[model samples]
Target: MTGPGRGTTADTPVVVAARRTPIGTAGGALRAVTVDALAAPVLAALAGTLGGPVDDVLLGNVFGPGGNPARVAALAAGLGDDVPGMTVDRQCASGLAAILTAAAGIRAGDGAGYLAGGAESPSTTPTRTWADGTVYTRAPFAPTGDPDPDMGPAADDVAVRAGLSRRRLDAFAARSHARAVDAQRSGRFDDELVPVGAVLTDERPRDRFTPERLARFRPAFTPGGVHTAANSCGVNDGAAAVALVPEWRRRELGVPGLALVSAATRGCPPADLGLGAVPALAALRDRPRSPDAVEFTEAFAGQALACLDAAGIDGHRVSPDGGAIALGHPWGASGAVLVVRLFHRLVVQGRGETGIAALSSGGGLGVATSWRVVR
Candidate 1:
């Protein structure tokens, strides 16, 4: 698929505006909200700002209502039927995939503007009864007969293989919470968060974090395993959206944007999927320069540490405003949420010029997308 070069130019696809709903813990503030309901508000906020009508809408979702979520969000947002919509599901990487798809459309000369992102409502996820009168929840994380191990156990496997100690994982989790709380106190998240009702901020960041508190939890997946609930992401609900337009349109609209540079997706074995981000970053190693900032989703502290270590990325350069470990992981929405964070930091706050967002997904998928502030 076509994509932008590293340099900013009139032909490049630029992200004009990005916003997200406050991430809510499962069964928390957003439990009653539907995926479309959560997404429509963010979409409407972007539509209110774009100078021209949107050409299309693409959204990523996992475990949402079966109908076309993008179309539902568009209609609910009052965008006309002329705005075609599509929904994609690449599990946790779905959000970044949707963004990449929109960028590809601009490169292919298919359209001038698009709305894209991802949303999830884990609290509202459906439960199903199997053919043999057994109840099942969640689709298989891997292909049938392909050894579909759950992510927590897979994370434990990654820790064991990488020699990540339990103490190290606990330390990472504590740091994530502390950073998130600091960012919150400093108003770092004020600009990008579009309120969902009275819920004004992320629900998962712990204000009084202590390593001892993390150590009190038992292993969630295995006997004497490193992965505890404290070090893993919580099921969450939220939505995020971005307005993408050609660089020329951005200029005409008199709006600032982040220029799309490159993106790649790779896969690994499902049982060791947390390391998926390692190969994704390797593909982008030859870029014009190292990314000034990186957002690697914190699926589990051990796996995140392993991926960052393998990539040789220092902890200081990753997730400055905290990550999924503190903010909660809303599956489909987490990837796009990373982009929103990058835009806020690089473009809005002038923290850096270039940034990368990377995520590891269930079923052994990894996705990475790079962006540069429009000059």
Candidate 2:
């Protein structure tokens, strides 16, 4: 709960290093890789630069085989058996939740350093069935009596309620792809990426998507819905992790990083969960200034636009290099991917002094974290 104004500078948690695997579409290049396998390389990449032991390893995972994937990944990454690990699950917000949890622990004087992030492998996730031989794609986000629409339909509802037109949504999606393609060509994503197997770059961003092509697609969720496959993120497989240390330790290591300023998580109506990020961003306290750069998960163009509009943030201020709409969304990993992108932009590229990473999740959850570049 402690933020910049509430805590001493020396004790503030900072992200010294961040890395992520190239996101791959489900059943594509990363199909053979398990969740732990996808996470191990990213963890190893961060740990290799630390030069000291990590206090713990924390990972966010959804739909994994579930034997403590964090611990499995730590061992696979060769981080020594002494380093303990824990897994967290908060649907799509899991990754950001893990990072915030680590920062909270550091603020509480629990540990000096930690490894936290998220990983998801939709390609290798197993099918689940209830004891009564009933099959289900995912667990219910709300109780039986409450609204629990699937994400696609929920996105459609957001578009309808927010008065977002199909054309506007399509344009946003096309712009996302165009920006990602441009960033890719400019080598903007080169340094943050860690090769997984033979996958070196994100597999989802296309070279182009004309408005006419995007308009030809039919509604994907409701009969008259504005949501479509092109405007939504793809199911993906990938992992991302950050090396978190207290400010004192960051100074000792002599590395630039992101100083944790504030973090918040909020809840909204389950029926309109796609708009969750608005409330979360509003909950942050002691925010000294508006973020110069923001990395918001673009799970669905309509949902993203609705949230951004409600929050009174300009679309151009978010994900200048594109977002999940182009990069693909690997469930648990998507939130961490946002932070990784911010780290690259704020710390590596020296673009801004402050930045934010925000995402909306299933079950009406939203999470937002603010950081300042510590050079």
Whole-model Cα lDDT of every candidate shown, in order: 0.87, 0.89
lDDT of 1 at 213: 88
Question: For residue 201, what is the lDDT in candidate 2?
Answer: 92
Q: How close is candidate 2 to the true structure, as a TM-score?
A: 0.96
Q: After superposition, how far is residue 227 of candidate 2 from its true place, in Å?
A: 0.9
TM-score of predicted structure 1: 0.95
Looking at model 2, the pairs that clash are none
lDDT digits (tens) for residues 74-159 of candidate 1: 99999988888999999999998998899989888898888999999988887778999898776786778878777888899888
- Angstrom error of the Cα, residue 35, model 1: value is 0.5
> Ten-residue segment with the worst summed lDDT in candidate 2?
1-10
Q: What are the per-residue Cα lDDT tens digits for candidate 2 across 214-314?
A: 99999999999998899999999999999998887777788888888888899998888787898998897765457789889999999999998988788
